[model samples]
Target: MTRQILLLSVMSLWALCGATHVKADHYRLEFPGMDNVLPIASRPANASRIFYAVMFDAGSTGTRIHVYTFIQKQQGELPILDNEMFQSVKPGLSAFADTPEMGGDTVRQLLKVAKRTVPRLEWKRTPVVLRATAGLRLLPEQKAQALLEQVREVFDESPFFVPNNSVSIMDGTNEGILAWVTVNFLTGHLYSDSKNTVGILDLGGGSTQITFLPRSKKTIEAAPADHVAKFDMFNTTYELYTHSYLGNGLKAARLAALGALGAEGLEWQVFSSSCLPRKFREDWSFGGVTYKISGVVDGYTGFKPCYEEMLKVVQGIVHQPQELKGSSVFYAFSYYFDRAVDAGLIDGTQGGMVEVRDFRKRAKEVCNKMSKLRTVSPFLCMDMTYITCLLKEGFGFKESTVLQLTKKVNNVETSWALGATFDHLRNLNIH
Candidate 1:
C-alpha cells in the first residue's frame, strides 16, 4: 500500500509540475478524458494531453494491429490507457511464404485501420511497428527474413512514423515477458496498492508461453537456461520465470499428436491417429503446409487412447514450474480462452475462470463423443485433451488450480502488442 501511494505521489508530482521524460520505448498510452483537450504535443499544448502509438502483432494464426491513444493526465505524469482501436486479419503473414507480396499486402490492409484510427495530423508522429512471433520464427531462415523484408517495404510506404528498430521478430523470451507486462499493466497490478502479480499462460497456434515472477530462489535455480529473465520496471528490479515452447502450440500439437509430423506424402497417403474419429478424414493445414489426416478405422478410439496420444505431445517436453503448483493466479489467453468458449465452459463475450479439472472434464466429454459424433472436428478431441495435459501433467498444475480465461481486460485486447508499445515508449527520454 505504501509503495502504491508513493508511486502515485511521484506520478502526481510529474503530472502537476512539468516535464516527465517518458522514454520512447516505455511510454504507456493513456487517456483519462480528453474531449476538448489538445494533445500535449500540439502547438496549443495545454489540451495536448493525448498521444498515439500503432502496434502490429504478426502472430502464428493471425495479424493484429492496435491503435492506442494515451493521455498525459497532466504535463509530465505517466500516461494511462484511455482507449484502444484494434483490428486483426487472418492466415498470418507466414501463410504467404511463397508470395512475399501478398504477405506485405496483409500488413498494408491492416494499415488502413491505423490510418483511420490515428488522426491525419498525428500520422507523422505516431510510431508504427511490426513484431512477428512464433509463426515466422518457425519458417526457414531465408524465407523468414524475406517475409520480414517484404513487410518492411509496407511499413516504409505507410505515413506513420517508422522507428529504426520498429520491424523485426521478437525473441520468444521477450514475447512471454511483454505479454506478462501487458497483463499486469492492464490489471492495474503494476501501478496499484497491491504489488502482487499474476501468471500468464498464452497458447498460440504455433507456440505457447508461460511467464510469471517467481516466489522462491529454488524456482530460479531449477529453471532451464534462458527460461528466467531479469528486467527493471518502475524502479524495481524483477526476476521473472518465462519460457516459450515453439512446437507445443494447440494447432501444431494437433499435428504432432496425429503422428503426421514430417510425413511428406500428404496427397498420396493419409496420416491416421486414435485421437480422431474412427472414420473421420480431412485435409489439415498449418504454417502454409497441408496434410491429409484421418482416424484409425481399424484401431481403438475414445478418451483414453486420445488422451494418451495428446499427452505425448506435451508430456516430457514441457518443464513443470515448481511455483505453478502452489497457490497463485493464472490468466490463460489466446487458444486457452478460445477452446474454453468452444466447449461451452464459458461465454466468449465474457471469458470466465475455471479450475484445471474443467479442461480434463471437457476433454473426456468431447473425446468420448467423437466415436459417435463424426460430424465434429476429429482433432477437437486431441486439442482439448492436449490442453488438459498442458495444464495438469505437463505443467504440474493441480486439478483444483484456478485459471482466469480472458481475451480482453477493460476492452483492450490482452496481448503483447500493448506491452510492445509500452516497451517502445520506454526507449524515449520524455522528461
Candidate 2:
C-alpha cells in the first residue's frame, strides 16, 4: 500500500530555487524542513536517503514559503514525503512593484524561515525557487521584470542551489494545471484513471482558475484553443481543460464589480455599490493601487440588484464548458473557501460539501440581513452574491451541483505549489 503523507496546520504554497535527487513512484519531490518535528525512523539498505526543497509562492495578495522533507527508503523508489514548514507575509510583492528593492527584501525575510528549518549542512544542496502569480502578471512589464530581477539577486545571495529562471512570473494556464495536480495527488488519485481525478477551483486575489479532465469530447472541441492544456507527469500524459482568468479573482472581481478596475483619479472618486452595507465606506487596495469605495447610502441594497451587478462580471465573460452541467467532482479553495467559512456556510477547520444552490441561498440570507450581520465583513453580501452568479451564470453549473470546499487533504494543503515542485524536480533530473 502507498502511504501518502500530507501536512496539516502548516503553511500554504510553493518554494524557491533548484532540484533534488529523489524520485517517487509517480512523481519526484525534494523539500527540506520539518524533519525534526517527525521522529526519524532508522533504515537499512539505503539508510533512508533524505532530500529537501524550498518553494516560494509570490502571490498577488501575499508571499509564502513551503519547506518540504522527503525520505527515500530505497534507491529509485518513491520518497516518503513528510510534513512541510510554511510561512507567509502580506501586502504581496506587487505592492512593492515600484520599489523593487523592497520587494526583494520581503523574499530575503522569508528565506530566514527556510534557513532555520533546513539543517545547516544541507543548505548548499537544497534547491530554492520562486514563482509569481497573477499579482506580478498585472504589473507593467518593466515593473514586473524589475521586481523579478530583484528577487533573482536575493536568490543568488542565498546559500541554497538556485536554478536558472528561478524567479519569474508563472503563466495562468500552468497555475490551474498545477493546482489540479496538487489536489489529485493528495487524494491518492494520481495513479488512477483520468475520470477518477477531481477538478480544482482556485480563487486567488488577482485571478481565478478552473481545471478538470473532461470526460466528454464535446468539452474539448467546444473550448477555446488555449483552454486545453496537455502535460506529462509521473510518466503519464494528461490533457486537461484548464484556464486562469486574470482579473477574475476575488479581490480583482470586487474592483471590477465596483467599476473601479482601471478607473483613474482615485483621489476624488468614491466608487459605490449596493453590495456593501448601506452606510459602509472605506478604501480598498489591490495590486499596488488603492481605491475609495462605499455603499449606496440612500439607494437600494440587497441580493436582487447585487446579483445583477455581479452577473455583469460573469455572464458572457466566463466561458461555460459544455460538460460542467453534468455531475462532476470539484474542490474549491482559496477565497472560495474563505468566504464560505465567513458566511457560516462551512466550518473553517473542517471543510464540507455544499451545493451550488447553497451559495445562492446564503447570498440571499446574507444580503437581506447585512445590518444584523455587521460583525461579518461588510462585503459579505457582495461576495456571496458574486459567487452565486459566477457559478450558475458564468460556469453554467446546475443549482444541484455539489462542490467540495477544502484547504487541506489529509494533512497537506491542496495547492499548486506541490505539483510545481514535482514539475521542477522532473526538469532537473536530480537523480
Candidate 3:
C-alpha cells in the first residue's frame, strides 16, 4: 500500500511540471508606463506560444496605451491581432507641470488590470519599453527628468515588477521612428527589401515631427556606439531629421489664421470690435504675445470680412510649398476642433473658421502637384476618412503584408509595435 501511494504522488508531480511549462509558453506582458492598463482573458492552456507588446504614446492632449499579442500559428498564417487602446485623462497645461508621481499613479492603475487578466504572466522575462513622444520631450529638462524617474519608480513595484533589463525611455528621434513604424504597419507598407526612403510627418496636439529615413541596405542596424546612432528601416539605413515644432494641430491652426494679416493684422481694439468680445479676445491670447490693433467695438461690427481673411491664411499655409505640400504628410486632425464643431463653438462660414474638408482638399492638391513636379508620388496619406475605412473593413491581410514588405524594401521599419518587437526578438535569438 505504501509503494502504491508513492507512485501516485510521483505521477501527480509530473503532471504539475508539464502544466507549468505549458503556461510559460503562453505569457503576457505590458509595455511603456501605462495610463490605461489592459487585461487579457484567461490564457489558452493549449496555445502553442504567445507574446505580448505594449506602446505608450504620451502626447500633449492625452496619453494612448496600445496592447497587442502574438499567438503562435497552429497551421496556416497567423492573423494580425487588433490592438486595444486606452486613453488617459485629457491633459491640461497643469498636468504637464505635475510631478511624475501623478503619471505613475495612472500607470499603476493600468497594470492592476493586466495582472488580473493575463494568465501566468511573468514580469521578469517580458520586455517592456516606455516611450514619451513630442509632449514630454518639449517639457523643461527638470520636469522631464522628474517624470521619467517617477515612471521608473512605479514599475519597480506592483504586479508589473518589470525587470531592470526590460524598461527604457526612448529619445524623441527614436520615438518618432517607432511612431513611423506603427503607422506604416497599420497602413500595410512595411517591406523587407527596398531602397525607398520614407518621410513621415506626424502632427499632434502639442507638437509636430518631420522624420526622414535615408536609404540603407540592411533589415536592422544597431544603434551606433555613440550616444546617438542611425536606425535603418529594412534594406535602408536611415538618419533622423526631425523638428519638434511646438504648438501642433490646435495651435498651428490658430496661429496660421491669426497671423494671416501679417504685420498689419488686427490690434486688440480691432479684435475686440470684431465678433469676439474683449474678454474672449483676452482669453484667446492665453500666454502668447498679443497683437495690437485699432478699431473698438463700434469699428468692427459685422466682421464677416475678418473671418474670410482668417480662412484664406489657413488655406495658404496648408497649401504652402514650404510647409507640407510635397512631403508624404500624415496629418491627424481628429483631436483638433472636435468640440468646436460639435458644440457650435465657431461658425464654419466665419472668416476665422477652418473645417476638416479644407485640410483634406489641400492634401489632395499637394499630392496632385507632387505627382507632376517631382515625379515621385506622395507615398501615403492618412486622414480621418482613410482611418475610418481601414477600421470598418478590417484592413485586408494582403494589403498589410504588402505594406510591411514594401517598408522592408525601402529599408524603413513599419510603424507596428509587434513588427518592431519581432525584430528585437530575432536579435535576441528568442524565435
lDDT of 3 by residue, 1-431 (tens): 23332232222212211212224344222222321222343555655545455544455555544454444433222323323333344452225455567776766666654554344455433444455554565566677767667667766775443534343344544545555554444434444343243445444554544444433222114222221235543324444444334444443334443452223434433332232222232323321224542222454422243344334433322211122222232412233223222223334333123333443343334323332322222111112222222211221112111111122111222233433443343321110
The lDDT, on a scale of 0 to 1, for candidate 3 is 0.38
RMSD of each: 5.9, 5.9, 15.2
TM-score per prediction, in order, is: 0.89, 0.88, 0.51
Q: Give lDDT tens digits, candidate 2, residues 1-431.
A: 12423422111221211123333433333333323222344457757677788989999999999887766555433455676788889989999988989999999999999999889877876779899999999899999999999999999999987876688898899889888877877776665233478899998999999999999888999999989988754344677899899998888889999999989899999999989887788888888898999889887899998988998888788999989999999999998899999999999999999999999999999999887765458989998898899889988999999999998886667778887776676541211
Output the number of the lDDT-best candidate: 2
Clashes within 3 Å, all models in order: 32, 26, 40
The positional error of residue 227 in candidate 1, measured at the CA in angstroms, is 1.2
Identify the runs in model 2 with alpha carbons over 4 angstroms from their true place. Answer: 1-45, 192-195, 373-376, 428-431
- lDDT per residue as tens, model 1, 100-166: 8899999999999989988898887788899999889889888888999998889888898787777
lDDT of each: 0.79, 0.82, 0.38
lDDT (Cα) of model 1: 0.79
**Angstrom error at residue 429, model 2:** 13
Winner on TM-score between 1 and 3 is: 1
Query: How accurate locally is residue 70 in candidate 3, as Cα lDDT from 0 to 100?
Result: 41
Model 2 lDDT vs. the true structure?
Answer: 0.82
